[model samples]
Target: MSSILYEQSLSFKRPLDFVFTYLADHSHMSDWAPSVTSASKTTPGPVRVGTHFDIQMRFGLSDLSLDYHVTALEHPQYIELKGKGETFSIVERLRLEGEGDHCHLLYQIEVYYQEPVSKLVRFFSPIVKSSIKKDLVYLQKALDQQPSSWKPTLWSKMGDRLLLPGMLHFSKKGFASAKDRWIGVTEDLTGRNIVITGPTSGIGAAVARQLAKLNANLIFVCRNEKKALIFADALEVEGYPRPRIEIADISSVLEVEALAARLLEKGEPIHALINNAGALFNQRGVSAEGLELSFATLLLGPFILTERLYPLLKKAGEARVINVSSGGMYMQAIALDDMEFEKEDYNGDKAYARAKRGLVDMTELWAERWKEDGIVVHAMHPGWADTAGVSAAMPKFYDWTKTWLRSPEQGADTVTWLAASKEARETSGLFWLDRTPHTTSMIPGTRSAPRHQSLLRERLEEYSQKLSAVASQSFR
Candidate 1:
């Protein structure tokens, strides 16, 4: 056969961008494309005209390599790639329709088998059509499953190592790029019980709404009852279950303990607990109970709540504890000797960063501590989102980056993935951004010392023990 065309039409209930991005990216071409063992993009940036990829593919019983080029491209609509090997030249085209769901996809590929391979191609033609159709079905399943890891291009690697490009990835464009490689999130939470702190606003609210749509039984941890009720009502209006509101300030060890006690009494298996409640203290301050406000809210409270609720988490058999840290944490190291900012001059941002760093350290420690018990602990930063917290905490920074900032939904995406995705459960203690494992330390010496790691747990235990001795309020 001199020229053979294999074409298939596919329809999926996936967004056009979602399908289009998958088809255009070189990292995933091997995933759904038949006989491709590996594929790599040679050019940086999104797939566009003149982009180049080197491909390793299987040709019958022989190993073959091809140089592929992006010949044409259009957004969420069309893609065309042409590849040349020693004996074969191939062209693949994809066209998509519909907005975000109920999608229609057109896929076509033409292989020109020249000279030596022409005879072999003729013999394999019949089986090739059926196999191609099966691969198209596999493509739909891949889109639905949304497995997100991909080999980063050189530019993307630079984005992680460089300050400016790395920070740019925290924006909407970054989310879009990260989202492109995502396979899918197919898990449903109809019977799952998820606990989300600070769900009344910002990233937490976004996470809650997304999980609510998944039919997860959610417990909203909000400091205010009225806002919680209103948020729950909104979800109910969307036809999700009315979230069970637990009124307790996450900053209060006493309140968190009380709340944990109530959940323990309820004896429900908690599938996931999202410690998303956080604040950036501008002034050095103390909570009502005289604890350092930053430490209490960001470190101490989440620590105590996760510890006390260990039983509930273990009950679920496979549970995840997601600690929400911040990208700012990459700047600071854990201050073991001066954990409360007592010995050093207090900088609020430094304090916040330190607490987040400690939380990530704790995530590592506890993942090991609870691994035998079937509980996975993970930490994430919500990226830079246009949340009230950001506006209140860093007004000037917010103003400068507001347009580039991720929406609360984008901010919460990784956390939601961690809580609900099968892929997330495979690993624990790794810090993540954009559904990919990120370097826990961007700068030298930001990682906690082994000594500090030991002290973090010991000191937390000491605080809990000492507080229990003096705390007047009991567990809720």
Candidate 2:
């Protein structure tokens, strides 16, 4: 089989020099290229012809590790790199041409697949070309940002580890403060209809207050009406608008469906939906739908609610969905077989972690699918927070890690940022923490394969539709 060649070109709304400068800095490759999971300069000193770097990219179910060496450099006009790997060799060329203020980028990719793989490459050429053009859009957007934003500081590289010890289980409120984490944040969601679950306490309560300050019309969904009403009263006393309240046990799919129905009936466009209601139960329990409690609350309920509310979200033109997941999800794999914990002995922590994992996974799929509809879905973990839920659920660990735990306000910072920030709207389907996007999986075995991830999304949609039909029939 002959070598496969895939090429694409794009015109960026930036100067030729500016585009060249940004693209020359290979460190920013991961930010723009979705397939490039990670990259690093293996060779030291400034980048020039013959300088070497390594990149780990996604190739279907596996990673394609490649070493790239700069072969040619023609200053602001042209540059080329040659990559060698186990299964393939690649030659990438970028030729920049200036046209007034903008630059036309002629990018070409030549792949020499080793033997048996060339046939497969030929078959997927169309999809490959499409993905290349899609990645170019991300590249264009990233280049539009200030060059300074592309560089990471020394402290950011540590990511809160120095300020807090590894023994700490949660994120600290004051930790990211030194960086002025929320500086330049001025999102006024005034008059926007924002729905938030579990607004009675902890992160949810914190987010509600923040959004209220922004004059958003908040609609609180919670199992406890009294707590929600009390919170609303406090808001009202503080001169904030009285927020609309809806009572429902979020752990129950039927209740979530009914709640969605009421919201739909109102016909108001929902600007954003934040799925912040979650719990780590010490004992195993099933929801009204026979789903495990943690699975029901953390994953299933939010999934169904988001699925049902699609019409309202679309109606908002550019609405966002934020799923409040937990950093604890890093510890576990997506237990597809034991999603409900039916087969194995139920461990509440594992169940909670698995459910959060499922939620994050679904967020990725939803973001990809809903982008065309102008809807963005994102999942973020609150890190470690000093919340009543934590105190009650895991007391001993809480007692030890309490000193390092984030205040509810600290925990809600990223959630509020995601809900309100314009910069965040640029990217979707990413797992976020501390206002920065992080990889969904750190440990090798924990990451869900692409095929399995797709399967899970399908299964979730099927279940949501099935339950929705049942709920509709019962309502009749």
TM-score for all models, in order of appearance: 0.71, 0.66
For model 1, residues 1-476, the per-residue Cα lDDT tens digits are 48779887878776776667657766455545555554666775446789898887654566689999988898878899999989889899988898647778888989888887797876887766665666566677766665656445565677768999889778866765565466545455889999999998999998897787567999999998999998898778655688998999878767777798789989999999999988899998887568888999999999889998999999999999999999999999988888789997889999999999999999999998898998999998878899999999999999999988877877887888899888888888888887777777879988887678989899988988777555544432
By TM-score, the best candidate is 1
The alpha-carbon lDDT assigned to residue 211 of candidate 2 equals 82
RMSD of each: 12.1, 18.3
Please report, in order, the local distance difference test score of every candidate based on alpha carbons: 0.82, 0.78
* Pairs clashing within candidate 2: 170-384, 171-384
> In candidate 1, residue 451 scores what lDDT?
74
For model 1, the stretches where C-alpha displacement exceeds 4 angstroms are 1-139, 142-146, 150-156, 472-476
For model 1, what is the error of residue 337's alpha carbon versus the real structure, in angstroms, after optimal superposition?
1.6
